[model samples]
Target: MSWQQIQPFLVALAIGLLLGLERERSHTAGKLPAGSRSFALLSLLGAVAASVGQWTVVAGLVAVGALAAIAYLRTSEDDSGTTTEIAVLVAYLLGALAYTRPAAAAALAVVVAALLVSKTRIHRFAREIVSDIELADAIKFFVVALVILPLLPDRGLGPYGVLNPAKVWLLVVLLTGIGWIGYIGVRALGPERGLLVTGLAGGFVSATATTASMGRLSRTVASPRAPLAGALVANLATFMQLLIVIGLIDGDVLRRLWPPVVLGAILLVGTAAFVYRRAIRGPREDLTTEERPDIEPTTASRPFALRPALLLAAVLIVALLVGRWGTDVLGPNGAVLAAFAAGLADAHAGAIGAATLASQGGITVNTALTAIAAALGSNLLVKCVLAFTAGGRRFGLGFLAGMALPAVAFTLAMVMTMTMR
Candidate 1:
């Protein structure tokens, strides 16, 4: 027989052996009906029977099920589960599948074995790690991302053709997903690691929101140092995300943008590290303690807020309109202004629009870079304002130190690159 014809039977046997090994390993804990040899034989039976006819495979499956039932009855344990029996039936089917689709059969077997092995970790995560509210929020996030997002129209709509429902919903998903990561990190790691973890993670989702949240926290805490450190670090996400956004819009733009952006992020991180050291070493009495009056951490209550995500969407929509209008009215100059304005709301929107324009040959690469840089500057300024308004002077000043040096470094990098070109 050819390799193809003989390969299926061999695969079927392998699948059975793999599953049987897992079942046998698990058998130490309980009275499992099937073990390595029994499962291997069951798979071999399915492959041989299916090779004869489809009906033979079905009959074999039924027979295995009947034998499993008899085994369960003989054991007569009230608490006995049917997992092994179900697995036996699945293994038999996989053996049959191996004849026609050996690759699929092997893949499914691996997946099943993986699921079996991961049982403990899965249970531990579900039972102990994830909170009930987090689970509910995850369900909601899925609904929005999968159910609602797919249903939205993909094309741009509205008077100026600025609104694309799919894209808008996509932003919602992206923002919420980013925020959720930070929320989970902060929740899982606890405040012991404090602002550094929270800020870095939260920055990915919404640096502005992180700034506001951290700022608010700063006002309530005795020291304001931790929140100040976190707020500064959160701005790093802004530049990091800029790289991602521009790369999505135009690779050329990203290629040109990365040098300055990366330099800025490194400077910001260095500044944040300094502030963090100072904050951690600052007077204990000046910091939040169990006895101190502190604002309840937002990460504990919700993974990501629906209201903020929707508001962000609203801001992006406005930026889109203004950006399109700017391009139409003032040509390239208007585009830069639009980017600056949009950057104040969200740097990503401005960068994306500018990059799109550059990609379309409507603007020069230099012009596109300028627009993106303008947006970044505006966004940073907004963060600074938020630090002052929400976190007060101490937090604002601390954040200023973190942000200013980076801004200077980035500006110098941009100038050096431009001059070199």
Candidate 2:
């Protein structure tokens, strides 16, 4: 037989085997449904039926359902779990899918098998780990991203074609998604894993928030080592996020910025590591992940930052408008000024504004690059102030020391990238 002709059957067989293995392992105590051989045969029957005709496929499914129903009825009512029954139906469908779309069928079969395999973990996560509020938040996220995003007019609206509902809300969704992931990470790991994990995750969502939280922790905690270290680490996200902005807003900007941004991140990581080591002076502090201070960076049960996300969305939209208007009115410096102002509130907005403007020919690429740097510098300025005011002098000094080398490295890299251009 030709490879094309044989491929679907092979895929169907593989699907049956995968699901059967999981079900067989899970059926430790039940007078259960079909096992490996039975599932395999069922899948083969489905493939054969599909190959024959539509009527054959329908008849096969009906017959299989009847047999499955009979098997369920014969088993005691006390042992009435429908997972296997549902899986049986899915297996039949996957087999049919395999006939026309073998690759898709194989992928879906793996997903089905994984679901069956992770039954316990999924149950635990839904019931024990997830709270009602988090579940609601997840639904809200889905509605916002899936439902509303599609409905929003993609074309620019409002002043100077700056306000595009879909695009602006997309920015909000991206920010919230990042925060939600960080939320899950911190909650799953808990406060036991030291502030390093917390810092990095939180920073990815909002470096300013992370820096402020770490700063507050520094003042209250016995040893400010973890807090100080965490604050320094949070800035790593700022540098990394530059790349995310450039990549998303403009490819040309990404091509120019990636090297410097990547090297800067590495430099920051190395610098943060040095500080983390120095700060962990005793066992009570952040000496180890398992045995560390009782400081918790993750707040209780919040899935994502709603207000800040909205605020950042506003800032980003304004930045875009400002970049356009400022350039039109006052030239390149206007874009730079707008970027710096926006960066003080949120650097992502600034970088995005600059790259977006450059892509649109509203400003020269060189101006965009300068604006991005200004944004970063201004954002750093705000962070420095936050560290000093919120974390106290020692934490502020420590954070600065940790950042100094990395900042120098980042500046040099940025200069080289520009000069090479």
Candidate 3:
């Protein structure tokens, strides 16, 4: 029992004494159960025993285990439940006696003790909110973002110059990411704010889909003013989508087109606002108590499905090949027609093909612009038809009017610009 050998024991005891003192004060205030002196003595005895049992670490562990069991029995008799005091006693012994890996063991003990102490507050928070399904959905979204997107290949393949696995998957990732974010926002905000926010967010995900959903909701929901506001918001999302797509493909092109698109959207929003205001002000009898349409949260059927990615890639390759083949066979007219056909199912590939060709100097800017417009125009027509068919007459008509008017105005402006140039 040299003085130098005893120093480590005393140091361990001091550390235990400090922790026990804090616990004792907490107990005095009814926040804990054990006192400082008892803990300090236990720590000192454990450290000395550990120093003496240096040849057999198991002996020190046995001593600590016996002390912990006695403490647990005493605390159990007093409270009939609760593990805090017993845990503190065990921690004190381990901190004092666990010298082989003292620092790591002590750090872990502190963390475990803190967590045990926080159990009451943690239980209260767990009981307050957060359903099982919401938690599951959050985990599901994380799996999609972290697990799925990175696994796919990024190259082009097949007959038409069609398949780029990475690009197609990228589109899926973008749409899924946007939809998941909107779903979370809606869940947090509730339906009243959800409708407006969802419409704007959904537009970023898919404006055509948003427009269709809004139209259907309007038909069923009797609140003319709310639906009208929602519809206007959804349509505004369409212009935003246009800007987004343009920016994704070519920031320079989007920058160039910004002024006209912004001006048109502002005018459309003003008109829609005016119409809604006038309609609401006219008569109380016209307003009815229709149930709010149950707008389901958009879930990815399976965003990273291999088949869909392959199909998209196939379409793109075919579109590129057909676009090039057509341009050679029938010139600009052939390419525009090819773009229109491709646009019916998917507009992105056609637009990308045209843009690529233009960049290569194989196609003139005017021709590329015309093909892009035709592809978009064709896609818009398909959406309008689907909206009408799926949503019924009134929905169909309103959507048609809403979508067609701006589309025609934009097309005319583009046409005039092309002619002037």
Steric clash pairs (candidate 3): 160-317, 160-318, 161-317, 162-313, 162-316, 162-317
Better of 1 and 2 by lDDT: 2
Better of 2 and 3 by TM-score: 2
Write the residue-wise lDDT of candidate 2 on 1-421 in tens digits: 9999988888888888788878888988757778888888788778878899889989989999998888888764746788888888788878888998999999999888889988998898778777788878878888878998899998878777767788778867876777777777776666666687788777877788788888877765666787777777777767766676577777888887887778878888887777678667644654434443454555323776467767888898889999999999999999999999999999888988888788878888878888998888899888888888888998888777777777777778878888875
TM-score of model 3 relative to the true fold? 0.56
User: What tens digits encode model 1's per-residue C-alpha lDDT throughout 1-421?
Assistant: 9998899899999999999999888767646688888888888888898899999998888898899889888655843777778888989999999988899999999999998878787777678778888888888888888899999999869746667778767766876776677677666665556567777777876788788888888766667777777777888888876776567657887887899999998888888887767776876633333344355434234776677677677766766666667777887788789889888888877777677667756677887888888888899899889888988887888788778888999988987775666
Number of backbone collisions per candidate, in order? 0, 0, 6
Estimated TM-score for each candidate: 0.77, 0.92, 0.56
Error of 1 at 1 (Å): 8.7
What's the lDDT for all of these models? 0.78, 0.80, 0.59
Evaluated at residue 220, the lDDT of candidate 1 is 69
TM-score winner among the candidates?
Answer: 2
Q: Give the candidates in order of TM-score, highest first.
A: 2, 1, 3
**Which candidate would rank higher by lDDT, 2 or 3?**
2
Two-way TM-score contest, 1 vs 3, winner = 1
